[model samples]
Target chain A: MSSEYDTTETLDVKGQSCPMPIVKTKQAIDGLEAGNVLEVVATDSGSISDIQGWADGTDGVELLEQVEGDDLYTHYVKKTE
Target chain B: MSTDNPTTSVDDADSEVDAAELQALRERVEELEASMAAVDDGDDQQKMTIVATQGSFDMAYPPLILASTAAAFGWEVIVFHTFWGLDILHEEKSQDLKLSAVGNPNMPMPNALAALPGMDAMATKMMQKKIDENGTATIEELIDVSLESGVDLQACQMTIELMEYDEDDFYDGVTTGVGAATAIQHMAESDVQLLV
Candidate 1:
């Protein structure tokens, strides 16, 4: 069975540092249509907190599922209008 | 024909004018150099001034971190907050700003390493303390350093209305209702422009 919040977009932000990841992710969010979802994978430790903070601050962006593994972070966030 | 004269000269009028202009520029440069050397040799510990622009809470740290540390190193540092970054201009709100991590699992935060079950709150508090220890200078310290070193701090007026924050919500060094044009002008005057 597929997860409820499936990945509609994938952003690879590896090896990049703080602010760049957030900046790029914000661009992604802007491009996304409401009700869609995005799967984000990153190696930066700051992205987790930054993305969550951004997702909370805006409307129609819902972080639906989160799974943290050994070396990276995987998140599925749905777009909500 | 070969126009191969190595020192091909200009006409007398143009050559005379160019020579005079060059001489004047050279003399002015020498005077400037002497003044700079005097300032450098003297005990006047002021010259460089920087204006920092911080728009968000997360965006707040880099500017403060850089400015306070720059101040510690004896460079004049100013932090200008326009929008959400101004939230930290107040001692109370600044101390309480936390990162929300439910869907944003990619904030490049060190707390992600703690990935313990429900460790986000702990991670956030720890992050705050870490930032403090890292000379992630507080808004209060920024104000103090700014005052001591003649640094000017201003808040963007338009951002104030967008966020519905009042002037009374800021610290003593904080000036509210400044326009972006002013900040842009300051940034233009600065040798560096960081968008944090």
Candidate 2:
């Protein structure tokens, strides 16, 4: 997943559900500089929509890509103020 | 000559009226578009308000979950805990809130069995186990997440007085003794208002 897109940081939130994935994602994204890409790996099936919806509604962040791989959901998000 | 061109005069008059109306409509569209663009770029944070009326372990999850989730989405969140929901903010009661099977249609057991002594406690224990197994955030953890995410957790003032709960019974970040009028004002402006 890292090979697909250059990521500044990767957050793995496996075995966590509802709001935790997004909560932790927001926290991680907050630490990155503008234009830095964050890669998030989540086990929750809902993270796909959760992260996408969160990024869509939230300012200063953009979801670049989302990939589902072998029971894991991966998302590439960019900080765009 | 004028009588012969009466139809042309009517057509000219209609064309002039249409031109004026079209210009007015075009200006209105431009104003609307500009305002819409401003909204898209402005700091218009979405707001969500929830009224939590139940204190059961099961019922407690919904309001907190939605509040934290909305906060995660960068929306302003407010949760008003009233009546039995006061247990959710009570320092000790929050950890001990029970899931009563009695009179609950969702409980798989028959009503008679649900009414048996220790049934509610057993159900609550089982639910807690499931929650742990699912890796779901506990009520305490959710409260912390909500507070850290800037969700406003309000405890109803009337409920506090009626239940005789001390001011210190709630968690640290809670906005205790908030009035219904205050909650109503928030709800009125909230983009989403829920009764959970």
- Estimate, for each residue in B131-174, the C-alpha lDDT of model 1 and write its tens digit: 65543445455456455544566677787788777778777767
State the lDDT of candidate 2 residue by residue for B34-118, as single tens digits.
9998997554878999999999999999999999989988889999999999899999999999999999998999999999999
DockQ of each: 0.02, 0.63
lDDT of 2 at A74: 91
Model 2: which residue pairs collide?
A: none
**Fnat for each predicted structure, in order:** 0.00, 0.83
List runs of model 2 lying over 4 Å from the truth: B1-43
Q: lDDT (0-100) at residue B21 of candidate 2?
A: 100
For model 2, the interface Cα RMSD in angstroms equals 1.0
| TM-score, A chain, model 1 | 0.83
Candidate 2 per-residue C-alpha lDDT over A50-71 given as tens digits, one digit per residue, 9 for 90 to 100: 8988998888999999999899
Candidate 1 chain B, run of 10 with poorest lDDT: B43-52
Among the numbered candidates, top TM-score falls to 2
